[model samples]
Target: MPSGPEVLQAIDWRQPWLAGWREWGEPVAQAVADGLPLHEALNHRSAAPVRFVPQAALPPGEAYERYIFNSGLCPTREGLHDFFNGLCWMRFPRIKTRLNQLQAAEIAAAGVAPLRGPVRDALTVFDENAAFLLAPPPLWEALMGKDWQALFVALRPLWPQARLVLFGHALLEKLVYPRKPITAHVYLAPPAIDTIANLDAWLAADLGADKLAGKPFVPLPVLGVPGWWPENENFSFYDDSLVFRPRR
Candidate 1:
C-alpha cells in the first residue's frame, strides 16, 4: 500500500512539464493504486464543474465530438491519459473548455487535418502542456531568449506572479518515460491570487476565449525554471551555450 505522494513520487520530476502536476497527481495516483475509478469519485466532488463519463457512451468515432461539444461533458476514458485529463479539467476548466470548443470546431470544419491548422496546433499544445505565465517585460524577454538565469534567478522576487500550470494528460503520459524539451505554452495572464487556490483552478480560471486573442502563445522550455527540474537547480542545464547563451 503506497501513499498518494509515494505513488506520484515514482514519476520523474526531472521532466519540467511533469514538474507542474507533481502536486495534483497525488489523489489521482492514490485512486489509481487503490483500484478506484475516477468516474464515480468525480460525481461526489461538489466542486467539480463538469461530469465525468468513463468511455462516454457515444456513437464511436467523430460523432462523439459533437456530443461532448454540446453537452459540456468531458470524456474520461481509461488509462493514465484520461486520469490526468480529468485532473486537468478540474484544474483548468475555462482554458480546457475553450480548447475543446476550438478542437471541436476544427474537427467539424476540416475533419482533422493531418498536419493540423494553426488553431488546432495551438489547441493541441495548450491541451498537453500549457503554463499560466505572469511576468514582467524583462523576464518575458529573458524567457524568449531562452536565458534561464535571467528568467528564473535574477527575476526571483517577481516569481509570486509567475505561475505555471501543467494541464495536459499527454504531458503526463510522455513523462512516464521522461525526455527533454519539456514543452509548454506560456499563457500570459495574471491569475486571481486569492480566488483560485490550486494549480488546477489557476490554470482553469473562469476566463473566456477572447482574452487570448492576439496574444500569441510563446513556446517555452519548461525545464529552464530554477527549481522546477532537478537538473535546473545547480544551473548545470543552463550551461548549454548552444541553446541558452545570452544574446550579445
Candidate 2:
C-alpha cells in the first residue's frame, strides 16, 4: 500500500466534492509529509468524538462498528480509503458516531450473521456512499424523478444555489479516479443548512433506525452536478443513458 504522504500527493484536493474536507485534509497531509503515519497524523488532528487507532488495535472477532461504539476508537489503516474515513470522522463526528451507534445496536440485536438486515445495510450504504444535497425544489424534484434533462439542463442555473456536500468517505476515495458512472446515494439536506457544521449536527439528529431502514436516497451521478466536471458544460453530456438512467 502507498504511504500516507504518497496518497496525499495523489489527491487534487480542489475537487468540489472534497471542499468540506480540504481544511482538515491539508494539515493531515502536511503531517504525513513530515513523516507521521496516516493514523497518527489523523489522531493528532482529531478533536472528534472518537479517537483514531491502528487497525490492529481492533481485537479479532470484534465487529468494526461495534469496536468503535464500545471503545470510542476507530480502527484505521494507511490508504486513501482509511485516510478519507479518518477525515470524515474528524469532519462529521456526530454523523459518524450516530452511524456507529446504529450499527452497533443492530449487531447487538442481530449478532454478526452473514446477512446484515435492512437497517444495518442501509446504515452501511449511507456510511459508504451517501451525499447530502441542499438544492432547490426543482433540482430535488427532477433528481428524485430521475429527470436528467430537467435536472442538468433545464434547471442548470439553479445549481449555483445548491450545495452538495459529500459525507461518505468511500465516495470521496472513489472520486480520486472520477468516472461518469460514479454515483452518490443522495440525501436532500433540510433547508437553510448553509454551513457544514450546521449540516453535520442537523443530519446526525435527523437519522433514526426506522428512517434509515427505508433507504431514503436518490441516485445522482457525481460528475453530473454542474461545475463539478468541465465536460458536463455541454448539454449532450446527459445523453449517456447508462449513467443518467430514466426513472422506471
**Which number leads on lDDT?**
2
As a whole number from 0 to 100, the lDDT of residue 83 in candidate 2 is 88
List of clashing residue pairs for candidate 2: none
lDDT of all the models against the reference?
Answer: 0.61, 0.89
- Poorest stretch of ten by lDDT in candidate 2: 1-10
The TM-score of candidate 1 is 0.72
lDDT tens string, model 1, 1-248?
Answer: 22232344366655555555555566566665566666654444424466777665555664455667877666666566666777776656665666777678778888855676666666666677666666666777777776677776778677666656555677656556554465666766554553434544454554334444444676666667655657666766767765455666
Candidate 1, superposed: residue stretches over 4 Å from native: 1-25, 112-115, 153-161, 172-180, 191-215, 241-248
- TM-score for all predictions? 0.72, 0.97
Tens-digit lDDT track of model 2 for 154-198: 998898888888978889888987888999999989767877788
Candidate 2, residue 52: how far the Cα is off, in Å: 0.9
Question: How many clashes (backbone atoms < 3 Å, residues ≥3 apart in a chain or on different chains) does model 1 have?
Answer: 2
C-alpha RMSD for every candidate: 5.1, 1.4
